[model samples]
Target: MGNWSMFTWCFCFAVTLIILIVELGGLQARFPLSWRNFPITYACYAALFCLSASIIYPTTYVQFLSHGRSRDHAIAATTFSCIACLAYATEVAWTRARPGEITGYMATVPGLLKVLETFVACVIFAFISNPYLYQHQPALEWCVAVYSICFILAAVAILLNLGDCTNMLPIPFPSFLSGLALLSVLFYATALVIWPLYQFNEKYGGQPRRSMDVSCSNRHTYYVCAWDRRLAVAILTAINLLAYVADLVYSARLVFVRV
Candidate 1:
């Protein structure tokens, strides 16, 4: 599961580069999914993916290598990954909606926040994929379910907007977006509270002693422990909760102010 997160960024980077090249070459129409929303959505996600990789890879693996070609290669990869993260971030900011400009929903504030919400959920997924992180407790498993369900809903919202299918919904799209954002805020808040309490509270059979554990610092140990992953998930849940709150505010403003 540790290597899985690393692989994800590699795959995302490759696909994103292909998409960018296709759009730049004016061959975007060759693919059915290459609509206006696709590029922005991909860029936003790619930026976060690379940012996570640049931080995680070095922290997890770089210290294990000695002063040799392998360490140098790892450092070089980290540097390039950071540069890629910046490139993707610049692309998102460049394409974001400007004042009085008519653009797709993906270019708007709520839309960009959707990208952040989904990316944080992705990192949460990676952290929780190790069964030892949540398998012992049903409540912990429920937290995982919360993450998955919210991720699916947010992804669906993005796809519907990208496909211009929001018009097919029975409700006004703004109201729909606001409703989903509010629902996400509620769900994520529950996870934010539940995950930390269940993971760190001794009353809940939680660790409550991860700070005193020194096994992770051993040179031979490269993978993060269950305690570390649990803490990571807790922090990420809180982050996504705040993102949903911001998204909800923007969406609500779109409903009322635009009216």
Candidate 2:
């Protein structure tokens, strides 16, 4: 289905958000505040998040294909299928690895660095692409480029711990990464709509306006204002980077505790 189809996306978003709230919030309530407990909670949440994606992807794909759209749609269908297969492989690997059996924090450092680099790359790409994508609307171009760059830096800070790598701040990389991935999915989907909106505005010379619902006005527009199309791709890339960070952290945490 097209990016504008909120009906399909909403269900997935709501379910995942609820899962996050329960998993993260529950861990904070149940466990003592320590680095040891962090990994357990993260693993639980990551598994749940993956399970939810498994359900949503098949349902959404079937609904999308039912419309009998074009070749591009077919390509998208195939790409998503590959992603689903990859997710399943990850789930299998995670399941086979016994919990609390890995150790050593420094071992995961390289993977975390790679994720930080990826986030920086994505933000830079968005900044460079924004002007070309939304040249007709300077307001949108600036908003998207600025916000994307800012968020990317924020994510990098969170990843690298603001250059004080010695500080073992227990930020849950898996949880953050999953959240980032979900955010990326939203960004890319929105970009699909924004790209067309940008093109339409360019061809027609009309200022693009959004629907006036309060949530849409505040949250949706805020996200959409970030130049929509190119920014969306950047945001999605950031999310994937975040997910990678999470996986690295998870693996690293296991190493530290087990060894």
Candidate 3:
């Protein structure tokens, strides 16, 4: 089952990548393709869009649908975070490219499929970025709001000079949100992997395991500190900044190489 899950994930990732490249006009330049062929492209992309929607959005739905404590909610939040990363990575092609012209590197679609994906992706992000968003939590609210501000700034950057608008990176709103979400996923997952926790016996207390009856399998393990989540958020904040720089460097290379 593990092997099959990995295979399925790779398959989906490859399919999404192909759709992105096709939308970038990469294939057409080699084989003489055009927007005229978009019907077929759109159909394939839309199908994939539905598949993505089904897989990723469900985590968010489950996250917000009901409230639960214990390590379960932590697991759900982590799952949502992971899915967000995958969604954002797949979306980078569309986000990194500029929305211009009908075809070529400037063409910013893979169509409405992108728009639909973006909207759903955003909804998921709005919630995960602040799981307490509906609860009037100020700190988390501020964190999520910062993302919104960054997104608006990115959209503004695209509208202005736009740095050749064709050769430079055009970070739009969806792209902005997706980029941070992706980086956040990395940090959160890494922390979760390293987090140390041991089950305890309610009858005899905390820390040391009194009996073999209380195994790691019986109850979920949680991080020793809530501060781990804070640490993950901080690391991702650095990652988000680095990602923009990387995008610039990558765009510059593509222009020079004419790839």
Which candidate number has the best TM-score?
Answer: 1
Kindly list the per-residue Cα lDDT of model 3 for residues 1-259, writing each as its tens digit.
Answer: 2232334446556755776787686574554334333333333344344455444444434344445563465455446545645555455454433533344332333222223323333443533553532234343445555545544444333333222242344555335434543443444333332221211223322223323332323432321132333344444444444444444444444344432
TM-score of each: 0.88, 0.29, 0.29
Off by over 4 Å in 3: 1-130, 133-139, 149-226, 245-259
Writing each residue's lDDT as its tens digit, candidate 2 over 1-259 gives: 2342333234434644664675677753543333332343333333333343445444544445445566457457445545544554464344433434453221243333333444444434644554654576664465455446445743553435323342453656544444444454455345444544543364555334434223234543114443444434545545545554554455445345544
Whole-model lDDT, model 1: 0.83
Best by lDDT: 1
Q: Which residue pairs collide in model 1, if any? A: none
Whole-model lDDT for model 2 versus the true structure? 0.44
Local lDDT at 22 for model 3: 74
lDDT of 2 at 237: 44
lDDT of 1 by residue, 1-259 (tens): 2374468567886887788788689886777673778888888888887888888778777766789998998888888889989998999999999878888899888999998988889878877877877888898888888999999999999989877788899999999999999889888888888888888888997777776455455534456766777888888888899899999999999889953
